[model samples]
Target: MFDIQEELKKLPDKPGVYIMKDANGIVIYVGKAVVLKNRVRQYFHQSANHPPKVQAMVAKISEFEYIITDSEVEALMLECNLIKKYKPKYNILLKDDKHYPYIKVTMNEEYPRILKTRRVEKDGAKYFGPYSSGFAVNDAIDTLKKLFPIKTCNRKLPNDIGKFRPCLNYHLKKCLGPCQGEVNKNEYHEMMRKICSFLSGQYDEILNDLKAQMEEAAEQLEFEKAAQIRNKISSMTQLSEKQKVLSTDGQDRDVIGFSRDATDLCIQVFFVRNGRVIGREHYIFEGEGDEEIGYSLSTFIKQFYNNVQFIPSEIVIQNEIEDSETISQWLTEKRGHKVSIRVPVRGELVRLVKMVSQNAEVSLKLFKDRLKRVDNVNEEGINQLMKLLELEQRPRRIEAYDISNTGSSEIVASMVVFIDGKPARQEYRKFKMKSVEQQNDYASMQETLYRRLSRAKKEKEENIEKPKFSDLPDLILVDGGFGHVSAAQQIADEFEYRLVIAGMAKDSRHRTKSLVYNGKEYELSAYMPLLRLITEIQDETHRVAVDYNRTLRAKRYTHSELDEIEGVGETRKKALLKHFKSLAAIKKADIAQLMEVQGINEKVAIKIYNYFRNK
Candidate 1:
């Protein structure tokens, strides 16, 4: 282990970089910061100011390494990159695989078609929404079909384009006669154009024209056209009935309304086009922040549209943003037309915003209520963590750390986040060991915490992100009994602040142990659900980290020794290792059964068969 305090003294106060290593000299973490001195020095602070776990992390600082940076923003960008590359244990990692699905309507086609998609690809199609509920999209599609009569089958019109016979949809009157061509091509195209216009945020004009035509057709003895228009009118009427109308005038406008409790934010945007509420959307963001509800709403809308390719003509804001004029100008220029940003002042617009606000409020309340019995993590938990840390307020979510290394080789750390009184699995992190030389828990903890907290600070200083604790955490739980907590404490003290730190002391069996608060310890069993929850968190975090550690170790071991030949991935390697119970047995097995493992494909089986055939 290296001398950590001495290393901290040597760290440049100017903004730059920092590196952390474990007992075996393996680089467990890497990060950049604006102020190296204050950031690096916080690890050796008082235990009372930290959660028992964090206090334990602080105690374990064997060594720390740091570099300087010119500004916090640069540090932030650099930090995100490094964390991504190394995958440190403690981080607010943005999940990369999942995506929101949207409904796309290609209005430009001669006959517009609706499609389901997970992303709004730039194929010149109009995107309706990122509906989180599959049932919602299904229902909307069904309802829309009733009004528009889009073809539900894969048949073409009478030109033999692909028509076989009229499908059930035609019999059910839910589809225009594309199959039999009882409907003229021109008339069908006209219907498609009308649907296209409605989907493209121009419903009022389409509705009005249909009404006028319906009246004129009835007078001109065109009963069929009049009946068709009448059906369209009825469908539109039913849709309008389901909607909570926000406005009635023909103002091509869009309104954004939102609500947020201390830990979550929900925004509802009503798409009011031509004086009627045509369509709408809702979004929820759960993360760290300090902005009040109104300000949060403002920031959200701004960031949201910053990435938006389409800017509506008129945007009705629920609250004022500081750079409204600038943003409005930018949007107007992009739109190639005039754009107005307004916070409605006591008219129909205000009434609309209020309605949206009420809806958002209800949505948030519903969400909170749904999560109520799950785990009650409130301000008190945050305060309790904060007060214990000797800081200002309790942290709403606390991130804890511990590095698990079998020796100098399999170094890794587990990061577990406790939100309210429960764990937020979405926020948990795992770090694979990197460029460090040896195994050292103290140094590893130091580096992991340094990277996590410093990056958080960089976000705040640069205005790209608010302070993590700005939303704050209640406590930081460290995996080790004492060393990890002490290292965390030192880091806090150096920052010249108090944060509740605690150590999760594990038993000799490496199972659920107890908590060390201040200079004393308490059994985890006394906490019941909380204790059980913590154990699960601790166990999960440990498994995640150690599993990664083993993976890396195996990767190295396989490439260097066991997997000296071709035809080996994780699963194949596992089968060979397990069935034979050793590399030697696998090397000894004949080709006939060498290909018998579950995942071993024929080609791979042959390769394995051949390699070990001569072994």
Candidate 2:
């Protein structure tokens, strides 16, 4: 077993990253510390002063590891990288994984193709945007195409340049007909350069160039070409006039606003590039009602920029953050220039913040109503349960528990959460029944409920980020008869946990039959909505518990013999097993076949080859 105290004693006082792992050796949290010794030791020695979430995390931290970095900035960078790789349970993550649309110019190809895409790759292609709206990006692309007669096809240019005839786009003067060799390389390259300039927001330069082309075409007596150039210039001018100019100083800035209710917080950002508003994006964070605006902004800034490609010169906000200087330095380094974080109290900037805040407020109100409608389907059940059981609250957040085990081995308890009458799957949690080693469902139920509610009480009292079980449930339901309900209620009473406790009883066929509350049984009629909701919760709880137990049992059953091999860690072992799909295939495989698995380099392949051969 790893000695946590001994490891704490040996920690170096340096800037670094610390990874906290649970008893199962799974990384549950990753953080960076300016002073490694002081920061890491706080989790063990002065945990009472830490937040409830941090303390709960500390309780499960059986071991921790650290990597020293040269500076605090480097430590911060490393922390972001590790969080992305491991996706620790306690960290604040970017909820949306959808990539915004960008205008991609295929500069690597002979005849470049301009198209709209969501992915940005490093292949010598020029990308513009990360536009919030796909329609807006498409509109921009369409305008560019009308202005410049560029090819928008998948033809193999230069190889079959003159092999195929021109299409309708060529007849309509929408394309330069590169496939028909109508436009030379130099002329096509010039037009592409102009398109690039236009996409770069150099509208004045593109307009002047178009005017010069129109005059030249007119002098050559090409009235058709002159008319096309004149039309392009007119369209470009109209688009330029449509842009809303907030300032003429050409400063790049981002205006931030905050809004929230009791359950959710919404943050809206207006991306102002070159003094014009380009686009806006809103992000929603759960459970930030009591959080300080400054702290929330700090967390939002870090997580927001973790994946963002563009960093503005200035960020204007309504409140000041605690680590504004550090974040500014980080942003400055990211953008290769100075980046300012300003909290404006007066003047034009304040007005901008107010405008953004109004937008945020509207967005939050609309989003919250939408989310409430999604949960209102179960609202009647929640209300009915509260009234029937004489509960203290509306049972908006109900938690159902079930214990699953196979002959006392790999025993576990699942806590399925339902918030606002709907299942909050992300908030559901599972416990491994630490205290109760045997297959005693009542004892396991008591221990799990006590542990869960105690942590929730601490978190609620301490005003910490109540992640998952840390948030107190309005009602608790255990899967069993009266015995389970009594056990859970006793635990709650002993811990002073403020929650209504009940139990679900099963019929002869092992299906949900009724609710057991306060030593009384309430039958669940098949047609009742309340009964249907409770039945669904009970079934989900049982399935979650059984699935978790099965996973644990399967891991114990597959204790691979390859684990004894030297230099073969869990990653490599899994890689080899995945490639061969079984031990028998691995034993019969050669070095080349072993090397076929990614991350299994030649040296490791030879080691595995030699080990199986020697055996």
Off by over 4 Å in 2: 1-7, 23-25, 43-63, 106-112, 119-125, 155-160, 184-190, 202-244, 251-254, 292-295, 311-319, 322-351, 376-615
Model 1 C-alpha RMSD vs. true structure (Å) is 25.7
Model 2 clashing residue pairs (backbone): none
lDDT of 2 by residue, 1-615 (tens): 899999999999899999999999999988888899998888887525654345557878999999999888788778878888898876655576466777888888878889998777778988766577899788888888888789988988888887887899999988989998777888787777777766656688888878899999999999998998898888888766645566667677889998865335788988776676767898876544334568678767876776777677899987788778877888899878899999998888888889889999999888756654765547877777777777876787889999999987888999999887778999888999788878899999988988787777777778786454566777888999888998888898898765678888876546566799888987654224566577679988999999999999988887787877777888998888888899999999998988889888889888888888988
True lDDT of residue 345, candidate 2: 84
RMSD of each: 25.7, 28.7
| lDDT tens readout by residue for model 1, 1-615 | 476766667777687667666566654556555578876666565434543333444444456666566665455445545655665432323333234455667655444567666665667776754444466566666667878778665333334544476677777777775656566766776776666566444567878987999999999999998998898788776655544455555566778887864334678777665466655666765531112445455445444554444556889978886546655765676567988889988877888899888888888778656654554544333344343435565455667776888777777887777666566877777766565548888778777766666666667678773344333345777887776789888877765556678887775445555777687766543233344445556766777787878888877765723465566766678877777787777667666667676776778767776776666
Alpha-carbon local distance difference test for all models: 0.64, 0.80
* TM-score of each prediction: 0.42, 0.54
TM-score of 2: 0.54
Best by lDDT: 2
Deviating ranges (above 4 Å) for candidate 1: 1-98, 153-190, 213-231, 241-364, 371-615
